[model samples]
Target: MDLINTCFEMCDYIEQNGVVRLAGNVKLRDNLKKELLHFLIYISMTDGRYGEEEKAFIKKKLGFDVSASMAADIKNRNMLGAGYITRVPETFKYFILANAGHKIKNDRYDNKEARTLAETYRKLGQEYLAANTGSTEVEINVLSSYCVMLDENLKSYGLLRPDYKSVAIQAETADEKEPDADELIAELNSLTGLTAVKEDVNALINLLKVQKMREQMGMKQTSVNKHLVFMGNPGTGKTTVARLLARIYKAIGAISKGHLVEVDRSGLVCGYIGQTASKTAEVIESALGGVLFIDEAYTLTNGKGQGDFGQEAVDTLLKGMEDHRDDLVVIVAGYTELMEEFLDSNPGLRSRFNKFINFEDYTAEEEVEILINNCKKQEYMLSRDALEEARRFFTERVANKPEGYANARDVRNYLEKAISNQASRIVGLKDVDKNILAMLEKEDLVGIEL
Candidate 1:
């Protein structure tokens, strides 16, 4: 049945039963009734035809007159947690008046609904009442019990929403914690020392904007950024960017859901024959609405023989990426050379990851900045002379630290330990003063002996 007829039927059922107890045979339908009541009220109030019918319907269904006096007790004046009355809470005063107004405006009625609507508005305050108005088809039954905690008392009571805007009001009440894309990008830029990578990220943002515009215009062409490869050394912020990409995907409605699922070889290839594909496919399903970032993805090709699960994982990954091409974004990260070899193992991999962003090793100057930033992060003091000494030491070390040296990471670790040692030496000097600690000079730099 259409929504209005269905609502009238539910209203009739509730009136005859006095409780509309949604427990047994018609439980699902009863649940549907509870969920869709507010929407029905909205429709009933649209032109005031169904108001008196709704009141009589509600009086029979709920066994109570949904009067203005009762609305005052439930309406939250402070706007702290009042708007949509769901299930049993009679807080939605607007719904009550709108219902009354609709009934009074009916051609079959003898009186006007203005007095009732006006009286309810005066008691509830029109500004406060207006803010809580929402759409007609809101389904409160679908709302989680936790979501309706403010009106938990109504779980057993069939209440009318005095406010017609319950759905929108509840949405506004929900905590909006998702980070804005620009703010996250700015934060990411501040965290990483990779200038070229940041510039590429900015370009990606622009591309997302274009993608968004196309989506808004009802253009359904496949997205331009389906596959991406993050070619970078360890600790270069590849995973961080992938996380932001998930949010960007959500903002543009490219995916039904948006979340970032990060895993490596262990999460994909299980140690069994014919099992790896299913395992990897399951992981992809979980990441359907967001980004799936595979760190050290080269390891997925580590098996020596044809019987290995590694090849199976690789095959599964290739297929899964295609199957979920419309919604999922897969980013594989590893050392640049190894990643190239990995792509070469299966021709499909090479064809799939068409875009790559290489993360170059940090320069000596960048490494120094990384060390200072690390110090600041840990609340350590690095005096000007000490900073210069540390920078010079790292520059010399980088020149001779061998090919596999940890680069910026090693510098950060070394600086962190040096500053920790300095702090330990001065720990007992509680009254030594913050200024003196702040002014710690080159001599204060802990040597290798510490």
Candidate 2:
């Protein structure tokens, strides 16, 4: 292409997704990564063919590879994890510019992505120019224009992204190593719409840190209570944040292990006579040196018959707390009003689980983001029209504020239904491309009312 056309293409991207559109946008960051991969392909597919050698080259350099048939398509549009992108140093703007199943986000995000390509092109283009006597000036213009466009793209990507913030999170894989203290803290920050929870957790961490410092210097330590009361509707990340706190506790030397054990009323209480203490004791023993998260804890005390052994479980649990005061961190969770009543049921309970953190229902935007993230975890995307429908769906859901709404859990269930509809739409199709297979259209949501 001529310099005029080249400049036009470069200028077009600036306008398509400049500062306004690119700022703090997951979609645009993805676009930049896709463009980067395409640029890699542009230079590698010298004869316009994606061969095994080219594929191997990509696999060898990058941490991921694609099937032979998918070499050029699926590999080009892969989305790298946010941890890979945003975990780099401040010097690296940490943009997500490739999805090709490769681990390359720790790479420099400033100008290296463009400059490396430019240099490679310079070498390859020089060879071609030497053979064909092509215009050196044209090559110069091409590299210069690409570099300028890349800088602009990065600038826009950097506009709203300060240093590194959380990317919409996904489930951690089993093989992925556990995150350390700082990493756990970063993960907490990465969770969407947990502003108050994050603040409380940070404050607690800071206080623990200070207390540790004071004790080391032989100063008298202030009274501290790590046991917590988490009051929230279903699926508001009470368990998730509690798990992080457990790991954080271990990382900071507050606990011997960083594991999280979760249970509910049934996990504790028993129907057999005089067996509740033994059952609850086993559960407590398993959670020693870590965090034991109790969900719907109010059931243990609030609506029980006289024959019930819920009181035995409670007495056993309180004794365990006192016995393991140096290690065990108990976190009781349930709805706001019921949890308050649960605390009032026993004087011992009110004294131990004193700190309360409320988990609010997600707003419309956070719910939609959660929906999109859920799709990503399953290797799916939503069409622009579909996304608009989702935004509207969630907005209406939030406005109506449905009774018995399970915040994040509700979003996940809705996505499951949406994808089922997507499957039905594509089931009869003869061929499905990368884009077609991954996308859920607005029609998939049609007649699926709130």
Candidate 3:
């Protein structure tokens, strides 16, 4: 059977199970249930081997306590059997028909939801290879490709699709091989002033090399722990690092694709009731096989009372994290205290994200380096005296300012203003000499002075 059809079958069975109803007569949308079941199956088959580990992972994902009876039932059924088998019952035929009914009847199917269901379906079908299906065989690689199609179908609903390309689903090609060292170095050079941050990221690159080697050796490599939290003040290169990390992740095969999709409060949240989950799920769908960076993620819990849409966003985000664990890497960035509150607000959030990279406030010397780098990019040369003056000005006026206002961003603003001021001093003068240029200066740095 095609993977999409198999996914529908699994969804139907899962939704009909007695345990499914135990969550109460809660109106679980058919689309949502189908997508959730699809994710459960995907994580279980992570190593391309479906066994006890897959079952345990499924149970956790579905929020089920694996009882003895549940264990016995899974064993009897062909759910987690090794290799592929096509013994799915005829009764399961209703699922495919029912799913098809929605499309045939009105054609009012939300492609967003359909795409999500499709993704889950494609993943399940790809992972669970039947033991032996004769000479007319289906390959897991082919099935993974189908999942990408569904991802595109679902993404048609978004306002503007991201520019990054999705990785091809070919088992002949392994994801996460060693990246070109030169490319990695070029990217590192583009970033500035965070020596420690650069080193940490390089370490992750080396780790990926080791992981790729293990995969080549036929050893069960430890799952790449891709989860990370960026703890830092603003403009300290957290987001830049995240974008680079996505490329590295793709290069090393942590996810299927290495795109960077950014969203803050506006993307995943909704003010109305019953809408946040769908909204969040849609965002997750777009970010599959990529990095989903949530800047100021702590603000997602703002506002007073249960009516706050922020909480819904959080709930929705956590759900997506669990469902799309194998396909995406989420990086939440915000100030230290706010991030603390964010972690405290959700147990699942705290548990899944274990790696934290702290971005410290830049020192005076580092701030000077940053300004010089910015100056070079802007094609402006600051005289030695002007540069020293700008650095001293920033030290007194920006960095020493109050906690909420101090950051590398503030330093950049200072440099921009100084450049502007120096430019303004050199109006319509055709042949400005080096001596005249050397004397350029700014009355004050950019941004409000302390």
Per lDDT, the best of the predicted structures is 2
Q: Best by TM-score, which number?
A: 2
Candidate 1: stretches off by over 4 Å? 1-176, 219-222, 256-258, 304-306, 401-403, 430-450
User: Cα lDDT for residue 150, model 1?
Assistant: 23
Q: Taking the tens digit of each residue's C-alpha lDDT, what string does model 1 give over 1-450?
A: 333344344344433443333335454344433333343343234332333444454454434464433323222241212234233323222223333344323322123222222222122121111122231212112121212232222111222121111222233333855544433443434443555565555445444544455455565423466567888777566776676667656665666666788999889888777788899989998999788899999888866476678888888888888888888888899998889888988899988888787777677777776666666555566788988877777777667766556666676567656766667777787688766665545765546421
Q: Count the backbone clashes (under 3 Å) in each candidate.
A: 19, 4, 8
**Model 2: per-residue Cα lDDT over 142-218, one tens digit each:** 32333333333333343222112322132255665655554455556556676677667765664565456556656
Identify the runs in model 3 with alpha carbons over 4 angstroms from their true place.
Answer: 1-182, 432-450
Residues 1-450 of candidate 3: C-alpha lDDT, one tens digit per residue: 544444445554445542133245543344544344444343333344345544554454444454444554544463544332222222233333334333233322331223334434433442333211110122333333333333333333321122221122112256554443324333443354565565455545544544555466564554556778889888788877787778767866678888789999888788788787788888889999999999999888856375788888788777788888888889999988889888888788888887677887777776676676666555556766677677776677454557656566876677666656666767667899865554435443433342
> All models: lDDT?
0.54, 0.64, 0.57
For each candidate in turn, the TM-score is 0.55, 0.63, 0.56
Residue 159 in candidate 3, Cα distance off native in Å:
42
* Residue 93 lDDT (model 1): 28
